[model samples]
Each structure stands twice: as structure tokens, then as C-alpha cells.
Target: MNKNLIRRTAIVAAAGAASLVLAACGSSDDTSAGQSTPSAVSSAPAAQGQHNAADVAFAKGMIPHHRQAVEMADLAPTRAESAEAKKLADEIKKAQDPEIQTLSGWLTSWGEQVPAEGAMDHSAHGMAGMMTAEEMDKLKDSSGKAFDTAFMEMMIRHHEGAVAMAKTEKADGAFPDAQTMADAIIISQTAEITRMNSLLGKN
Candidate 1:
């Protein structure tokens, strides 16, 4: 071949190789961006459940226990004497009422039998820190400082029970959501218990 023709052929081959290299680099970048897609999904909130027996038990037990707390909180608006006492009661209700619904929703979503609608019929299984009929009656009957003291005493007991249950869920439960909720309960109720203890003049 002529010298000019040979040089032109060489130039054509070099251009093709450069095009292939550029295409390969583009493919590598696409793969790297695709790798990040999974990370984005992982950062999303976890799926709600894969609940185990311990999680169900925690939910069933805590709901009634929380309901009683709400009932007790409701009484505080009328019966509790101290502004601090009443405010605590209101805060308890605010925190627990939504938690009650969240727990019940999880149970239902898991195809578990939610506890009986009201008052947590603990007939089948007893929950910790439940108020006795007599105790609840006394709380309802008492007013002013008497009510304030009774409510705080009872609630401290209630919160202690919740913290215990939450700790168990953290240890034994399988569901991510349940365990997270349990952790939150342990943190919040522990603080509330401390506050109530101070209010009651206890160590």
C-alpha cells in the first residue's frame, strides 16, 4: 500500500480503540450509580414487621396497661390538685394514646387478635402493673392532694411495668419496629418514672 494510505488506516484503527475505551468507562460509571441504588433503598425505613411471639406478647400486654394509664390520665384533669400532677397526666395521655393505637395496628397487621376493645380484659393472661378494681375505685373516689398522690403512685408502678416489658421485647422480640418501639418506651417511661418519684417525695 502507498505510505499515505497506510497512515490513514492506522489513524482509523486508533480512533476505533478510543471509542471503545470511552464506552467502557461509561459502562463502569453506570454500574457505580446502580450500586448506590441499593443503598438508597436500605436507608428507607424498614418494613413494618416480621413479628415473633415475644413481640405479640409485648403488644397484647402493653395495650391494656397503656389504656389504664390513659384512663388514669383522664381522671387527672378533674381530680389531681397540683398543676404539675395534672400536666404530667396530660403528657402521659398524649404519649400513650397514640402508642396504644400503634400497638393495636401492628397486631392487626400481623394477623394477631387484638385485645378486647376496652379495659384490656386480662382474664386470659395477666399483665404487670395492672390497677386493681379497688385501687382504680379509690383513685376515682379521691380528689385533690389525695388523688394527686394516688395517681402518681399508681402511674409510677405502671411505668415501671412498661419499662420491664419493653426491655423484654428488646431482648426477645424479632420485629424491628417492635424492638424500636420498645427502646423508645424504655427511654421515655424511665424518665417519667424518675419525675414521678421526685413528685412523690420518694428516692
Candidate 2:
């Protein structure tokens, strides 16, 4: 009878130990799964939302710069004599308008200020390659071949300024999207500058 009692006690202990081991395995699996999920969800938004002061400045300054470029492009359809100049102006307006919207969206999402509509007076900021009021007026006063020549010359200078700003942003900005935009600007504007120079026989 004592032997039977000992055998029964050993079986019960073995069952309890096995149960504990199974429970520990289940708990470990649950913890690992929970940890992986939250990390995956968190990493993406953090990367997307990252920005710094340089990114903000790039967005702000480029807004007016792009707006002024668009304004100049708008004049070309009516005033320019060269077909190439008109086509180039059209392309500039199309590319930059969407970028303006995108930049504004990023600023709004970041709780930053979008540049005001009347902020065309880039002279106050002493922004590079920006036209003076007199220069704009002069362009407005001209037409035909004169308009084409003036537009190409001023745009070349404006594009050079934009390239400079983009280089700064690429080097100093933390936002990935802004950096990508800066790269695009550098490549596209440099090509456009070359094209304009060729059209003007300056190449």
C-alpha cells in the first residue's frame, strides 16, 4: 500500500511539471509576437514624419521661389517669340504647381507655416536668383524675341539659385522626402540650365 501511494505522488508531480513547461512556452511566444507587431507599426511613421529646421527652411523658401518661377512661366505663353521658350515655360508651370501643393501639405502636417500668397517679395529675404520688382516690370513691358531672350537669361540665373538651395537642403536636411526632392531639383534644373544656355547660343 505504501508503494502504491508513492507511485501516485510521483505521477502527479510529473504532470504538474509538464504543465508548467507548456505554459512557459506559450507565454514566450505571446511576448515575442506582441513585441514584433508594435515595432513594425511604429518604425514606418517615424521615418515618414522625420524633419528638421533645414527641411522647414527648404520648404518655405522654395515655395516662393517656385511661385515666382511659375509666374514667369505664365508670362511666356503670351509674350515669348520662340517656340522652345513657350514649351519650356509650359513644362515649368506643370512641374512646379504640383510641387507647391506637396510642399504646402508637408508644412501643414509638420505644424509649420506655408508661405503666404503675397510673399512674392523675395527681395526682403535676399533670396538668391530672385527678381526685383523693377526686373519683373521690365519683363512685363517686353514682348516677342526680346521677351524670349530676357526670359531665358533670367531663368538661367533663377535656376542656378534653386540648384544652390537644393544642394544646401540635401546636405543639411533630415527629412528623406525633402532630400529626394532636392536631388530631383538639382538634376532637373541643371539639365534645364544647359538647355537654356544652348538655346541662347551660350553653350
Candidate 3:
């Protein structure tokens, strides 16, 4: 009831209200700052299974290996003397080209890099059944029947390497798609290996 006291009380009430408003704003900012964005877990993991580091490495390694096989298969048409050798080479190209495309596509879908041409050194990896540089050179230099024989032999070894790599993928890789591809390589390459052996004898 004193006039000065009434004014003072009104001033104090305004200051307290302003302090409460500031406290509310500070609390809201603290809540916002404390919140975190969700981690990026892959949604397709259940459908394809969990792809780990091994699956990635397997894809990275195998893509180049398959590409080299395609390169060798391409050479067969030019180098083979025998009709059978040429036919086998043509068949190899047909089967492997689609597979190469499929594997490359899978790598892309998985957000992995497709191995560049000549990026991986076959000699350094020392994959079993890989032709040595000297061996490839010999095949390239040969002509006619010599080329046919060498090509069949070299291709058989190459297919064997593919089969080996596929088996590794099947055993170690997590994705169902990778295992399916591995099964295909096993079936196709086994048949090709047998056919190549017969062709070698005939040549």
C-alpha cells in the first residue's frame, strides 16, 4: 500500500518474469545441443546379410581377377588356330562378360570401387593358377596351333584361379549375392576346365 513500495514490487516482478523466460530459452538450447543424429546403419543388411570388411575386400580383389580372364578370353579369337579353341574362347567371352558386368554392378550398388584396369598386380598377389608374365608373353607371341595349345592351357589355369577365388568368396563373404555368384563360377568354370583339358589333348 505505500506508493513507492507498490512500484518497487512491480519492478521486481518484471525482472523475475524476464529471468524465467531466459532460463526456458537456455534449457531448450541445452536439449537441442545434447540430441544426436542417428548412426547410418544399412537397411539392406537383412536381405543381403551383413557385409563386413572381408566381403568388401573379396569384391575388390575378384573384380580385377575376372577382368583379366575376360582379357584372356578376348585374345582367344585372334590367337587360336583350331576351330575348337576359338569356339571355347568365344564361349568363355560370352559367359564371363555378363558375369563381369554383374559383379561390377554389385560393387557399385554396395558403394565400393570397381577395380581399375591394371590396378591390381597379379604377380604381386601371386594368386594360384595365375599365368606368369612370361607365360602371357609367350602366348601373345605364338601363332596358329602353338597359340591354340598355349591359350587353352593358360585359360584352364585362369579358370582354375577364378574358381579358387569364388570358393573363397563363398566361404568367407557375407552377402547372398556374392555366394550365388561364387556358385555360378564354380559350376561354369569346372565345366570349362574339363572342356579345356580335352581341347588341349586334341590340339
Candidate 4:
């Protein structure tokens, strides 16, 4: 071939190769971008999950409520005259301490502020059936059968409050774990209430 014709053919061949490479790169980039957008969107809802005001209230209110139950249970070992009461106290503390952790963890996962540990200020939490300072003081001062009676009465009321809160959560909360916990509280506390009533009968 002539030198001029050879040079023109080489230029055309190089241009065609460059165009194919550019088109292939753009196709790959477009495919990657298209794949990424749906993945990011699909993951967002799963990450958020189902959270609401009721779940927040349940966790916030119940943590302190459980703490108070633990505190009251601590008094049982020394002050309770009834063996039944002491045993029940141990049960209460065991169940509630871990529950406090579970509830706190939920609050953390939900991006809600967890209640500070050791703070039992439940006033204005819309929590029902909490004992007043005087009532707790009254229980602290009592001992023997008197202590047993007071403790049973107070705990029954306390459990009733917990049941009520759980019922509200079941009705209003959006989180599945929170609702499950709420159902559990209602069942367990109601049974405990029946047992407490029987304990009171012994006194």
C-alpha cells in the first residue's frame, strides 16, 4: 500500500478502538451506579426499622420502674419476715435487672437517649402505680408480718402499674421487640399478682 493510505487507515483503527473502550467504560459505570442506588435505598428502611413515640415512652418509663422494683426487692432479703417474700424478692431482682439492660439497649439502638443509671426520678413519666416517698419510707420502717403485708401490697400495686404500662405499649408501640416485652410483662406480672395475693393471705 501507499504510505499516505497506510497512515490514514491506522488513524481510523485507533479512533474506533478508543470509542469502544469509552462506551464500555460508560456502560460499566452506569450499571454500577444503577445497582448502587436501589441497594442504598433498600437498606435505609431496614436500618431505621419500626420505631415510634410509644416505644420510647415504654423504654424510658419502664427502666426506672424496673430499677425501683430492684431496689424494693433488695430490701426483702433483710426486712422480709416471710420466706416466700424473700424468695419472690430474689426472683424480682433477677428478672428486672436484665430487663433494665434490655430496655436500655433498645433505647440506644433507637437513637433515643437512655435514662441515666441510678436515677429513679419517674415523676411525669405518666407511669402509673408508683409509690410515693412516704410509702417507700413506710415499707422501709416496717418489719415481720407487718413488713410482709406492706411489701405484698406495695409489690402488687407496682406490678399492676407495670402491667398497665405494658398494655399501653402493646396497643401503641411500633417496635416488635418492645411489643413482645410488653406482652411478657403483662403475663408475668399478672401471674405474680395472683401469687402475691396468695402471699398476703398467709399474713
Residue ranges of candidate 4 with Cα displaced over 4 Å: 1-48, 122-126
Worst 10 residues of 1 by lDDT: 119-128
| Model 3 CA deviation exceeding 4 Å by range | 1-45, 122-124
How big is the positional error of residue 79 in model 2, measured in Å on the Cα after superposition? 0.5
Report the C-alpha lDDT of model 3 over 48-159, residue by residue, as the tens digit. Answer: 6567666676677666677777777677777778889888878877887787787787778878878777666644368666666688678888879988878888888888
Model 4: per-residue Cα lDDT over 47-105, one tens digit each: 45788999999999998899888988999888988899999999999999999999999
lDDT of 3 at 24: 70
Cα lDDT tens digits, model 2, 1-203, are: 99999999999998899668657766677777644654666588888889999999999989999999999999999999989999999989998899899999999999998988957544435898888778888999999999999999999999998999999999999898999999999999999999999999999
**Candidate 3, which ten residues in sequence have the lowest lDDT sum?**
33-42
Candidate 2 least-lDDT 10 residues: 33-42
- Among these predictions, the greatest lDDT belongs to 2
Clash statistics: count for each candidate: 0, 0, 0, 0
CA lDDT, every prediction?
Answer: 0.86, 0.90, 0.76, 0.86
TM for every model, in the order presented, reads 0.76, 0.78, 0.70, 0.73
lDDT pick, better of 2 and 4: 2
Candidate 3 is scored at a TM of 0.70
How many steric clashes does model 4 contain? 0
Task: Give the per-residue lDDT digits (tens) of candidate 1, residues 18-119.
Answer: 668666766677777655654565555555446789999899998888888999999998898999999999999999999999999998998998888674
